[model samples]
Target: MALDKHSDTFSLQRRNQNGSTAPLTNWGFRNETDPLTDVLLGSPAHLFHRATSSLSRKHLREAPCNIQVAQAQHAELVSTYKHFNVNVHMLEPEPELTMQVYSRDSSVMTPYGAFITAMSQWWRRGENYAAIRAYEKLGIPIYDMVTAGTFEGGDFNVIEEGCVLIGCGDARTNEPGARQVAGWFEAEGWEVRLAFIDEYYVHIDLMVVPIAEKLTAVCLACTEPGIVEWLEAKGHEIIDVPFPQTMALGCNLMSLGNDKVIAPTSSTYLIDQLRARGFEVAAVETAEISKTGGGIHCMAQALRRGD
Candidate 1:
């Protein structure tokens, strides 16, 4: 798949005409736990507090998010990424896209290319189009777009190089959408597992996220036993994050590879565990912005990792 950087003639679907799609030479990554070289982030300048989920709704009922504080927290997060020597790319902010701060929900970066997701919320649907524009500006070719049904990028969990654990939360990512994505990877000869979760969880990353090559952080209290067993069968060391912390988006963290991670400060359990293990953890405060619905990982989209 050759991407024309000088013009807007890049292919919309970069997947091979044949079953095996070749990985992009200059972009994309084989796995999540690779030294991150580039990341895509959205500006919190237009961020607004809305009832995007049960958690956000509760926060709104209790105390709405402080917009100024949220923007400052986002700046701190950007600084953390810069401190780690990772290149950060920001999406053009649109005033109407209040939830655009969560960049991970618009599209997913994979070895093949960017997979544009279908936004479940009416207000967020513009994000899909915005994602395409962002990719174009970055000179990244899109592998494909989800059309079977609604599927957000948060539900697309790439567990390893070729294996993926897709989440199907009826409200956000429906069964049809999950299977559609599963079928694409199946054709590419990758292992695909579908985990059906409750709507309240919003996304799979809320309860399960990969920490390293063979380490995963999971909320055992909420994750299904079968999923846990499957991970264990694959020799993955599970670090069980407590239920309360998980609800606070403790498990939703970004693995920068090379034993480094970016996590939310409120997730003390996960931060402590990572620190004890000698992992260089950049704990950024996200409590204010998270009230608008998303954490650290939700705010980023890995563009390139490990050459």
Candidate 2:
């Protein structure tokens, strides 16, 4: 299929043409908290790796991930996605990159198409090419590629239709790359907010997450006060997740939209808080897998999210 020049954005639907369902030509997403229709998950076949990030390195030095246990945990994550009726797509394995299981860092999904990322770590850079191959195989459009500086998809969060919050710690995503992303979104009429987080936190998703239309979970101890105030001013109810749990990836829960969320079972505090708010929660155990430095949100990339 060719690019639809007349259409403003690519469609994710497999349209029924004539008597058969036509192949998908494009896939896109606008926000994080939407009914997840399609997602990209990483394979466990190549997930065995030593600690790369500062956070994971500490624990990895003490005790590295048990490959078998990590693989089982990963399968549970995939099963959870399937149980929710989400269309799961896997990236082809890159044997040399063990941290590739955190597929969220490979690329950012936008309403226009995919923004292929530039990984900061040398060993993990190959994941970008794998993401490109996945997009091509799925027939998704490539909106842009970050060549200015290092940028990872985990730092790009679509908070609303016309608003995005990006994090730059100079490690995962640098100022140059963040500026480039901001410019692209601004040109498309989006109000982009830049959050400069501590490098230890890795990505903004680790500090702040949107779970519903006007509800967000934030790690108050680490998040900037201005960002919290801004979110509150926008009518977003902030749920403060404890610092200890935040370190455990508590704030990294995935929103399935319509007041539904998928979280890690180890994050009891977040699970209880989400439940108290009457949101449906699907909690999966990621104790073994998370030792590699990410949570459920980092493991899956949304391809299509419903408004």
Candidate 3:
């Protein structure tokens, strides 16, 4: 069954001191594993596009996607979200923007609001505007916009309410942008962990994902040793996803609260690991979509995490 276009049912309402409804400043996400009540899934209308970066070229191998199959895969994702009782919203498609389907790269959701990213790739820069429009439509306030340097939302992962891990590598999220965002978190008394990864890894999310409270999936081979150690020391259960599977985006899974997750079908190892650890796994075949340079986590951006 086709999912209906996103309704206003998920719109948040909060009362100000004056007894009038106002948008909450802390409306977005504080933790990735909280009850995922709302999310923004990117549109797949222009998914088939020319490769803009090495990651895209490597994953796509310069091959074209089967548009029909890609759309079908995306629908499965939406269906899974609905089945899990998650409110799904779609980014209004921009026919001219080919890479707009990866909504996670355009902006990041924070406890305060959404921070729009400064896209590194010229071809993907237009996606920021599309994301801003979508957020406005959803009544999600814009917390801040990145202006210091290039940054993508894929590099951010919230560990808990007061702790976050940000990836900093010149290839995607440069130091300036990472520092700017870090400052905001620090001012709020949050501990910000910086993971400096190799350029080969497009984002930290490609190597790390929080599956549940005190549990995380990590590509140990690629993720920095210090970062892994810090997580372990923080009492997180480390589920190590091997290099081969990680390269296929096995670590790029989304936590849908209640110990459930949505992952790519091809991520057999990670899916099995998650299930073995008692997580409900909702798998979708994203072969065609992944070829466009991202996996499930990279395709959807969390909007509201809790009730």
Clashing pairs in 2: none
Compute each candidate's TM-score over C-alphas: 0.96, 0.92, 0.89
Compute the lDDT of residue 21 as modeled in candidate 2. 25
Cα RMSD for predicted model 2 = 5.4
| Candidate 1 least-lDDT 10 residues | 2-11
Query: TM-score of predicted model 3?
Result: 0.89
For each candidate in the order shown, give its overall lDDT on alpha carbons. Answer: 0.90, 0.83, 0.81
Write the residue-wise lDDT of candidate 1 on 1-307 in tens digits.
6554323234688765445877777888888899999999999988989999999999999999999999999999999999999999999999989999999999999877898999999999999899999998887888889999999989988888899999999899999898988898998899999999999999999998999999999999999999999999999999999999899888989999999999988889888988999999999888999999888889999999993
User: What local lDDT score does residue 285 receive in model 1, on the 0 to 100 scale?
Assistant: 89
Regarding TM-score, does 1 or 2 come out ahead?
1
Model 3 scores a C-alpha lDDT of: 0.81
Go through the candidates in order and give the clash count of each.
0, 0, 0
Strongest candidate by TM-score: 1
lDDT of 3 by residue, 247-272 (tens): 87788898998888999888898899
Q: What global local distance difference test value does model 1 have?
A: 0.90
Compare candidates 2 and 3 on lDDT and give the better one. Answer: 2
**Between which residue pairs do clashes occur in model 1?**
none
Q: 1 or 2, which is superior by lDDT? A: 1
